[model samples]
Target: MKTLRAFITMVALVVVGYLAWNGYIEPEPDGDSTAKPTATAAPPVKPAKGVTVTSFRQASRLLKVIPEDRQAYLRSYFGKGWIDADKDCRDTRQEVLARDSLVPVSKGCRIYLGKWLSYYDNKTWTKSFQVQIDHLVPLAEAWDSGAYQWTKATRIRFANDLKEKRGLVPTTTSLNYDKLADDPQWYIPKVNKCKYIASWIAVKARWSMTVDQREKDAIDRVMKGCPDRKLTITRAKIGLLPFAAGTGTSNRNVTIDSIVYSGRSEKIILRNTGSSPAKLIGWVVRDEIGYGQYRMPKTVIPAGGTLTILSSEGRKRLDAAGNPVQHANWGDVWNNSGDTATLIDGKRKVADICRYTGDNSGKARC
Candidate 1:
């Protein structure tokens, strides 16, 4: 009986110690659910870091002025698909449409039939189909400029960025096609040219994508008329995990528990080993070879709960709150033979990672 009681006491002491340790390190939760384990919520994303150029000339100088390799471009490398960030059936195209629409857009899971004015040509449309979401920096151009060396996660982050409308905009289909993959030297918008050039420079400088001498020279020539035009680009804001924006410690207990890849597909399990719920908004799970990449939605992982991400749609999955979130379909991301799974936090910090190679059973514990 003494031995039994001693063992029970030891177990209780260990559990208490763990909770105390986590309570000290992790953000303390306050009365509010969103509060950090300590009552402060993590701050929502802000342009706290990166270069802030007040004028167009300064913004232009921020870019790595160099010649692009201009390699044979493959559109698929950058993965030009939109994401349903709000769980609305509509992808990024519809989101942009809704944002740009002057009229009330339909609010349905699979919808967004609305009106949009394409500033590229100063034309307006009543139907969403008439407008195209134009990347201020064309994907092909971005790839050549420097994106070719980026990982799939980086590519997806660039393509599906809904944080700011500066990078992507709604435009008429004809004009979008006309400007396809052409740099400023070859093509500059006829209307709203200053705004277009400013946005273009903003995108290039924000992504830290290089500019060839010709591209830089062209921008210099175009901006001569508007030399002091103001432009602001927010870089490193892509990984914004929504928070209350006050005093609180960042939760560092969330980590990858394991990576399971079958012969055909892949899934990663993220576990939060903290005392409080871990808000994983803006976090990213990606494989090294650009096959599977998932930027987490505005979701929370209960202290002890686990969330699984499949490369493609598998079964109906539920988050910690029992809410169903539509994870993006990354077609065949893992190498199956060998790959590395990395969990990157909103601050662009690698919280945890797991590597697996030649695992016939296809499960790697981190």
Candidate 2:
């Protein structure tokens, strides 16, 4: 009896223990149930440097095209060995794609270059379906700058040279066509100018290109602002000409109305003070700080007028005609290439000549 009673108690305890374990213990989570995930921190963005790059634009005047007489020769020469003429872009686009792109592909006859990134405007696109093929030196500019005299073969080579075409930086098609051939003076991007100038110069130098006076002046102006040596060509869009009024004649009476200094050049406010309206030829004199003194071309200031001057720091380093802008510390007389000016007889004149002895300070009181 005692043994049976003890066994029964043991069994009861065992059953209670088993019930507690089964009822209280939690089961493992099913495969479908999941724990919440922790959130991650994002990376910080950095600020842009000093200046931002912008789109490229055409200069003021319309760029001219090569003369018709040379077209046939160029076509025949460029067209030669073009066995796949029906579908391919001859050699110009093909070579350009090969040179400018990272991965260039050939589709039987037509060549296709991969996508490109435009540093100027920060746009990206592939060179597929007639995209990305552009002119390095614009076609119109070539015509005006002596391409008119080139033989058809020469023009054709110029038009389709892989080397030249390689410079056809991928930019907005509209902006490229807008430049049409005008000098940088009339056309240029407001930002990213240094790159634009350098690139334009590289193209001009490569082709041994000649420019008109305006074009030459444009090149000079652009080069003065370039900071980098390699970032030559960039995208561009034209800006309004703030100081193109007195471009033909020099030595015109100029007023120093406004003064602006960009990292690259100086912008001054001027007016036409000549008796008859004059064309601004070019710059002649500079101030101590290297700004242009704005003069008449023939060293003649008009009878009753004023002209403003624009200058670069480079100009102040040299004389009006490419000599040193030396100070007149040698003798009793002030002898700097650029002396300050005052209005005299309705004309703004520099103090360098014999008539204006004490007028170098640029004070109206004198």
Candidate 3:
């Protein structure tokens, strides 16, 4: 009987120890023991960089099909003349002069003495009048391509686009007149041929403008000689033009109006709902992963104006009335899903915030 009691005690102790080990040391099951395993979320994908011409052959292949529309070209269709689109009290021509002059501007919106390098003919000038603001792509060429079908507002915007660096250039007046309404078939100095062609391609592509057969052939021929040439085109959209009146503190209110996080063609729209113009010199747009900082040269937002920051790769979508939407280039800004965009002003104040999940279908939700 003693041996049987001892053996039973030993067995009980072993059973108790085993139970304690499982109860205290081992991991406990979830509330529902039969619950399925949770899935891990996949990593986000990065957007592709903007379209770049790797080679002349590639550029030739990518050229748009020649549009057969022989639209009537008229200067008035674009705009009455150079207007003060930026509302800086200086007209577009004066603004270009002020920006391109090597010397400091002397008078109000006038550059009496300055050095300007005209790339078209390898000439440099000191007199401001000697240099004419030449549109990289002429207005008539734009009409022949696709501008004829555009709304009046869109044409006006294209005609007086001071936002884009390549849109208008400071070249010798003689060169500007000689190359009037001519395509790439015209002569460009040997040194500037490559860049000239590239700029031409960039402007056409940015405006969604087409090329004629002759124009395409000319580009192809020029590019064939330049095998290693590469060109990247970036464009800025024009914001709303503020009215002359109400130049007060109330007009200085600027906000992050909208954001489009769709794939490569991401865009952020900023609006100045105030009565006075708001300067966005050191403004920043940040998403979860990356951010695009604005370094606008003349960073003034007119009252009731909207400034759109767009990605380089997005398709140029138009409004219902067929007016070309203006946008600035902000490459690969937002993620595909679960992203937050914050707009910070020069003073480091949060101007606006937009948060969304999943795809936005290229529309701004915030």
Evaluated with lDDT, which candidate comes out highest?
1
- Give residue 307's lDDT in candidate 3 (0 to 100): 71
Candidate 1 vs candidate 2: the lDDT winner is 1
The clash numbers for all candidates, in the given order, read 11, 40, 8
| Candidate 3 residue lDDT tens string, 113-134 | 7888888887989988898999
Top TM-score hit? 1
Instruction: Give the runs in model 3 whose Cα sits over 4 Å from its true position.
Output: 1-60, 187-190, 227-229, 235-366
Error of 3 at 140 (Å): 0.6
Estimate the TM-score of every prediction: 0.51, 0.37, 0.49
lDDT of 2 by residue, 1-366 (tens): 999999999999788788778886444465645644456877854434422232222321122332221111122322353232234445555555555555655554355547655544556657555344555566666655545444445555566554433346666555556665556767875656666666665555445455566666676677655543432232222221112232333343443343333323333333444465433343333334222233223223233433433343222233343322222111121132333432222122342322223333432221
lDDT per residue as tens, model 1, 1-366: 999999999999888789888885453465776764446888855555674747777788888887774543556666757877677687887777777788887786544467777877889888667878998899989888877556667777788878768888988988988989899988888888778888888888777788899888888888887748667778744321242122112358988888777655567778878777887655667788544666555567777777777666554568567634444476666655778988877665688888878766667777
The lDDT values for all models are 0.73, 0.44, 0.68
In model 2, the runs with Cα more than 4 Å from the true position are 1-90, 104-107, 111-113, 130-132, 190-192, 228-366
Greater TM-score among 2 and 3 belongs to 3
The weakest ten consecutive residues by lDDT in model 3 span 241-250
Off by over 4 Å in 1: 1-47, 51-53, 110-112, 237-366
Give me candidate 1's TM-score against the actual structure. 0.51
- Candidate 1, residue 267: lDDT: 70
